[model samples]
Target chain A: MQPDPRPFDEPWQAQAFGLVVHLHERGLFSWTEWAGTLSNVIAAEQSDTPTNAEYYRCWLTALEQILAQKKIATPDLIDITTQAWHRAAHATPHGQPIMLESDPKRIEVK
Target chain B: MHDHPHDHDNNLDPMTARVRALETILTDKGLVDPKAIDAIVDTYETKIGPRNGAKVIAKAWTNPDYADWLAKDATAAIADLGFTGRQGEHMQAVFNTPDQHNVVVCTLCSCYPWSVLGLPPVWYKSPPYRSRVVLEPRAVLAEFGLTLPETTKIRVWDSTAEVRYLVIPMRPEGTENMDESALVDLVTRDAMIGTGLPQVAS
Candidate 1:
């Protein structure tokens, strides 16, 4: 559960791992605790069978929640990260058109 | 991180202004604390860096057996290379074949195989990528300079729960004799995303 110091060997991996370490050092969930919680969440979501994507999403959601709960990241930081994500999305030339405004209230119920 | 005077300028872009507005609302609602922003930035800079992905790709290109192992059991395979846990413990790599083009997206949110590919790129987590990739994969891939034949089946992999996917694009033609390091150089971040294939420089 303690984030393996060697989990990431590449520079990028180390950098990413460093972010988590920073969060933990800042009083966010310890690496072990975070890994345990994430594993448990993934396990609970699994049925007799589970898809890879489902498992991926579960872990991601858990990571996001843990960060949010500890206040390790501000909404602004999340926004900036997500915005970068948006730019990558746009970089891809071919993909289905996705409607950003999904809330029923945001759409006129004609 | 260097200080940005431009960030403090009052004439904010529409997106920045909207973000500021949202921040104010969230702050007023006691949803987000102010100190958290600094912590977040610190984490991104000092903790989760981009080197993770680079390493995975480098290894994959260098070691065919390792690449095959990664395609089969990305988590354990990566761990064998001493890259496990943290953001990459649970991972998968989908192969992009001649007849089938694979693309990855996180529809609900920006779910990524961070352990292997490092952190998800900023755009991979964006609404446009998530919403559009599933619905319009060909158009998206096209933007990335990938034009698949109509007969080529486009399989969009959605990274959701504990399993995240990285694309293993077919090594380009005419680079059979290249050494691993040379091969690694051809695997770009975009190629791993399935937007482009690795091409040996002329």
Candidate 2:
């Protein structure tokens, strides 16, 4: 079967893509290290067979796991940040860039 | 075209939320500097993207030998101008002629020549474009507001592997007297993607 050649549907995917490359370039992790870690995570999650979107989800998961393992971040911190973004995004009006609100409650609807 | 997996949820996609969260976490922890990331992103978005490609196209317009070089070995020709890296390591330049029109799409993934084109636009990666362009090139081009002549045969190049394709749009007519800099100004990123044409002086 041929692989799907779809572009990222959202800006975040591109951002994630950039982040991964940037991190690797900065020597945070070697490509071989990333490949091994990512493949293992994908294998464990049965993401061995994943759609284009799911593939990036696997990339994120591996990234998170590696960062946590390396003590670069705590899983709890990531979760907290993720929920905050969700809330901010939900409160923001349509057709606006989803700017992160330092205090989620302070975001004006307008 | 396949319907994207998450359309009904009008909220920012979960991935976006997660990435933002990650950014925040990384920044707070001092593991990654947001400013540095922004600099890299800014460079690609502004300094490096299609402007680089425009210079190549413009040079090709003025220099026949250079055009021949690009046609024969895009990687080498582009590298000659210092536009070679990453997604563009393996490159191919396709030319458009009166009888032939070229458009590029990567049906499986968004593998663009970032060294030359920077980031792929959101629409390029959307399901409709990824799956439909190869099958219905005319319709997709039409939707982009590019109405080509019926006699112009459309050739859709599916960038299925390592070799990325860049469209060398035909130089607009009546620009015969224009210099390379003016011609470079006329070449927009969309034109290089074949969704738009070079600026026609009015």
Candidate 3:
């Protein structure tokens, strides 16, 4: 069907999509290997397919898996940063970009 | 169409931050370019679409030999037509006939032929569509406002990481004299997805 030209539902979706593509170009993993890892993660969903948001969430999960597999970063490392971003996002006022330095936890670490 | 406005990062969410975190981590490690991420996003978001696939569909309708090639080996045929090096490297052309209508769904993930169709529609990636398209294609298609006859057998092709299928909707009758470019206008993105039929040539 002729769907409206909406490539992504959200900006993060685009970032997630691009992040994988750029990573592949950097030689972290081949496209085939990336596809294989993504397929496996989606296969785990089995009969229950993901919603668009959840689908990209799967993308993020696969990215983490790929990075971890390559020993570039571990789940714990990503989780820490992800949580930090979450805190920063909450701390930031409306209409402001959520910079990582805005995270309250960073102050504790310092 | 969603309530979530993606234009501004200020109205934040968990997934948004999560991806940002990844980008930040990768950037810190000297493995990523923040600007490149924006560029890739812009290209996929605004530049790519199903027009490429529509061109292929139109060509197949106008050229019998091209149709044969598409039927035999879609990847090479489509690549020869100048659509390659995108999301799906392995692909197949699933033609819809008078008796048998073909529909595609990626029950595993969103395994679309991005080289041809660009990104899959949001509906195509939804849980309901991915599940119901297999168990009851007729019912699922009906939801998309495409109600094929009970006599017309509906075949649901499950896309895998290895091969993604593109549905070539049968050409509308009474367009034999139309040029390839004229025929292109009739082919809709949804037709290629098997969720919608092409517009009839006037």
Candidate 4:
């Protein structure tokens, strides 16, 4: 389903925003063009109610198009990212405790 | 556009329905080109994946001084390996200790450290994981079959701005003497996500 819109408003939201900006600045897509497309997609989805996956797919699609248009990254990059996305969706086992694998030689900073 | 039985409003399963609806809109609007998406995914898989991160992990395991350098400046350290851009240019590694287990979640959107870990998992970008992981990290970890010790302090890292984070999991027990490749085997995808510990084959 639709993600809680709250997180998208946080300061941390800028990370993704900045990523979009970087891609745009790199000539992938103009800010106006990207924003117009994204806003239109979001608005359309909002009219009918959207799922989380649907929204993400939309976002990823936008990213992919922009990257392709700019030729910032080759088609291969998109394939790899999508494959990882699919593999993780299916292969990530449920209900397991996760541990961080530290570099043994690295000192832990408090 | 075309009326599909699985429209967002009509679907019972919110997740599936939403994805379908969004896909329809994206396609209809020409916002997302599938061929392009596939291409981007392919690039990351072939050119930069966990192997790059593994190299960093391996070096840290074998070289004490290098590990020290990595902990201090993961970005520059990773750059030394010729892996830079997209996500890894500005990197930070959070170490997981016996008393402290660290996990990372973007919280906002899927702001992953692609430079090191390559592209993020689909779940990482999913609303369920992004929304819930920060709010209920322990429960999320439980889903991954990762249980922390009661005494262990749980720290959730939020990747923000220019800095991206990679979880440095503790070396599994009985693998102190093992070589790098053996150690890499223990460093699973979960370890990067801070959900599961790396296991060494006894």
| All models, RMSD in angstroms | 15.0, 10.3, 4.7, 17.4
Native interface contacts kept by each candidate, as a fraction: 0.00, 0.28, 0.59, 0.00
Model 1, runs deviating above 4 Å = A1-110, B1-64, B87-89
Q: Chain A vs. true chain A, TM-score per candidate?
A: 0.42, 0.80, 0.85, 0.44
What is the lDDT for B28 in model 3?
97
Candidate 1 steric clashes: 46
Tally clashing residue pairs in candidate 2.
8
Worst 10 residues of 1 chain A by lDDT: A1-10
Highest DockQ among the candidates is held by which one?
3
- Mind giving the per-residue lDDT tens digits that candidate 3 earns over B1-202? 4456554334457788788888888999999998988887887776667888999999998889999999999999999978885544688999999999999998756778887777887778776788888999998888889999889999999887678899999998888888999888888888998998998844
lDDT, candidate 3, A59-105, per-residue tens: 88899998998898888888898888888877786666668998888
lDDT of each: 0.58, 0.75, 0.83, 0.59
lDDT of 4 by residue, B35-145 (tens): 554444445535656666766777788788878988998888878988776522378888888888988886555567767676566566565776677788888999999
lDDT of 4 by residue, A35-92 (tens): 4566445444432334444555456456555656656544565444334333333333
The interface RMSD for candidate 1 is 13.9
In model 3, the runs with Cα more than 4 Å from the true position are A1-3, A30-51, A83-110, B1-12
Give per-model TM-scores: 0.53, 0.64, 0.82, 0.58
Q: Write the per-residue lDDT of candidate 2 for residues B13-34, one digit (tens) a residue.
A: 7788888888887666666776
lDDT of 2 by residue, A22-43 (tens): 7876778865577667656655
Ranking by lDDT: 3, 2, 4, 1
Error in Å for residue B135 of model 4: 2.1
lDDT of 4 at B106: 68
